[model samples]
Target: MASSPTELPIHRFNSFDGVELAYREMGEGRPLVLIHGYFSTAMVNWVRYGHAGKIADRGYRVIMPDLRGHGDSARPHDPAAYPHDALADDGFALIEHLGLTDYDLGGYSLGGRTAMRMLARGAKPGRAIVAGMGLDGILNTAGRGGYFRRVLTNLGSFERGTPEWLTEAFLKTVQGDPVALLNVLDTFADTPREAVEAIAMPVLIVAGKDDDDNGSAEALADLLPHGRHGVIPGNHMSAVTRPELGIAIAEFLSE
Candidate 1:
């Protein structure tokens, strides 16, 4: 039987920027790195959902990283510390630290955008998966970014039923660092259309049918040189936990 995420041990590493990062490795075979979304830890996004286990059982080694300021990584609240490419840099740095090549890579939401940006920055993975993200969000993060800024700046002070309120609740649910996350929002990556198109790789774009937050996953997939769109059960918040999401990702990477 493949080892479950809970059964796997946690390890730590230092990124190029000197921030401490935590990660977990499970199963053994071809390497696949999965980055957890914003306001989430690797365990919550991948392990709790059984996504990591499912992928590992499919004969692939899974490496799940806790993004800076999330999970067990360092929280740098200084705005200047959070660069546009900081998240992607952490991912590619992890790959380089491991001396890996031709490995599979991807992420969800923030992680998805990071994966896309990493690819644009020349981290060539054998296969790629972008989940819970759309094209426009990657190209122009200002709108969504501004929303987060408002939530954090006011500390989720909006009235109930408002987007700001919901966002703040979600942020609290994950126990995120207020200042650090504010910077994450401020320095979100902006990957241009041309940069995305230059990736001559098999890319899987996973989206929740009801998720219109980032935009349409199908539309984003159409922009890739070799992109395939996948629909999974649940909205952005619930989709990560659905087994269907894991199934789609495994099938795509294995092919």
Candidate 2:
């Protein structure tokens, strides 16, 4: 039988680089730390999507944290404030702060990339799920960096029928600090293909069926030592909210 941990009040801890991070914990069993995507908070990625509650019901203590520059965490707009693998370092810091040895980790989009880089940096979990990223996405950072930069600086007008136009419209709706997010672009990780392929941890790769912005999740899984792929029904923006996404993650982590 799985056990539940007592709910703790909001906690604040300094990340590896001294940046303050905010996190909340619920239920209990094995610890599962979930990272939200860029421009989104833990609340949006897990709580609103039902992943946190569903996972908690499954008897896992869910640890959801706002990444360094997003949500309730400290948001620094200076590019120098953002550093390599900064978010990953925050995740690891939370693990150590809570003294967790046995746990699972998962993240959506930017969060997933952070988790992958954490693994690349020797942070190990019982299992990992990289959601919303693919092979080409992780290997190539130049284009993404550029897109985000434009998303931060240019609100003028994206030419119709262009990716920039579509993305700008989405970014406009998200309640995130644009300047801080811009700095994040300057600091986003460019993890090597070899580093990703070398990860020996069992990983479940989840992506939307129609999300081509990133590479293929299935193809990326093939490159991993113990990777598998699952698809939810929507495009990138909507897939994270689908019930299937939570179900797949809970089932995968349970195994």
Candidate 3:
């Protein structure tokens, strides 16, 4: 039986550098590692919106991780804790810890970017899903990374109704740590075009109809050898909260 949203158990393990990371699991079957977005956790991105339940109900063991510096994971203040592609390193560590040799991988926004990093670094998930991300997001992380840096650096100053203000509001809603999140920014790495082209696994590049926040998802899909683009209703933020996102993912993975 699939676990109810509220019944999901939180699991912990040490990351590569001894940093404690957190993850939640539901259902039982072929493993599917689901990574959450920046300033978000497994609960908010997956469980709260019923995504995990929906995916799990489709016969998958949904493994959702709280990326370091976010959620219940260890938030190390030491700058040394965050190296280049630290989140990807943590993902690799999670795979090793769980011994996931023949599973699927997916993520949203930062999570999506991290999934790409993992694939580029040689993770061999049978299939992959990259949601709420686009070609620009993968090829050049600094544009979005720097935008978030400004938001964190100038938290309360943004005027209402502005994008920055909206982001800060979400940050407050999630109770994010500005300092640790800032450090996590150091881990962002630009994926080479060759890296993107080299990913031979079937990849579903799904994004919100109105989400061009990172770039063109269609373009990204076109670039991949076995990529396909799907659009759900809503923008980047709103789309994640919709059932359409989960439905699209379940449908694609089923195919």
Candidate 4:
């Protein structure tokens, strides 16, 4: 049986910018940090999917944090402040605050992007996994820019223009200021190609076989300096939910 949320060990740390961040710690070996995507909270992204327990079973200490402006963390309403660099800084702050010097890191979707940003900034994790995201920073720049513009244009027409399913999903996952999502999307547009190429650590890039928006998992593998690729049998969201996928991640990180 999965551990109940109340049963998991949770911790809080203060960022350099004074934001209070909440994180969950599990297992008991080499430390590993798990970052969730945009809109999704750490509990939903990591815990709900059973990744937390699997990592724990591997004898790896897992640290899952709710990024600032998401979940239990402080949500600042200023969209201009939620840049990728800032997100990377937040990860560094959490790791440093926890006194972890050589841990592993993994992220899904938006969190995966943040992981890439951390690598860009010279974060030296023992190993890393960038799941459900690709390293096409230049290509993503154009795609995300167009996507955010369309979202912004539709926000005012929320009731009439947005699909019911999408609205429901957004409402369920987004716990922070609405603008924070847009801001992060905007910041994603400016991610440089050089940054993607600068990552020197061994990286595992996992993507869904059906994830069309970010190109093929093979393509992402080709871009990394030391990247290995794996394909899970599902779409973007399903890739995060599947237990087998998490096991694959645990095995790779262990090696």
Clashes of each: 0, 1, 0, 0
The whole-model lDDT of each prediction reads 0.86, 0.83, 0.94, 0.75
TM-score of each: 0.95, 0.91, 0.98, 0.86
Model 4 per-residue lDDT tens digits across residues 223-255:
778889988878876778888778878999878
Q: What local lDDT score does residue 214 receive in model 2, on the 0 to 100 scale?
A: 72
Q: How many residue pairs clash in model 2?
A: 1
| Model 1: lowest-lDDT 10 consecutive positions | 1-10
Screening candidate 4 with a backbone cut-off below 3 angstroms (N, C-alpha, C), the clashing residue pairs are none
Q: Sort by lDDT, best first: what order? A: 3, 1, 2, 4
Q: Which digits, one per residue and each the tens of the lDDT, describe model 2 over residues 132-152?
A: 888777877667677678767
lDDT tens per residue, model 1, 124-210: 899999999998888988877876777788974689978778878878788888888877775587888999889998999998989
Judged by TM-score, which candidate is best? 3
Candidate 4 — what's its lDDT?
0.75
lDDT, model 2, position 201: 86
TM for candidate 2 is: 0.91
Superposed by TM-score, candidate 1 places the C-alpha of residue 156 at a distance from the truth, in angstroms, of 4.6
Give stretches of model 2 more than 4 Å off. 1-9, 159-166
Over the stretch 1-255, how does candidate 3's per-residue lDDT look in tens digits?
333688777899999999999999988899999999999999999989888889988999999999999999999889999999999999999999999899999999999999999999999999999999999999999999999999999989999999999999999899999999999999999999999999999999999999999999999999999999999999988999999999999988888
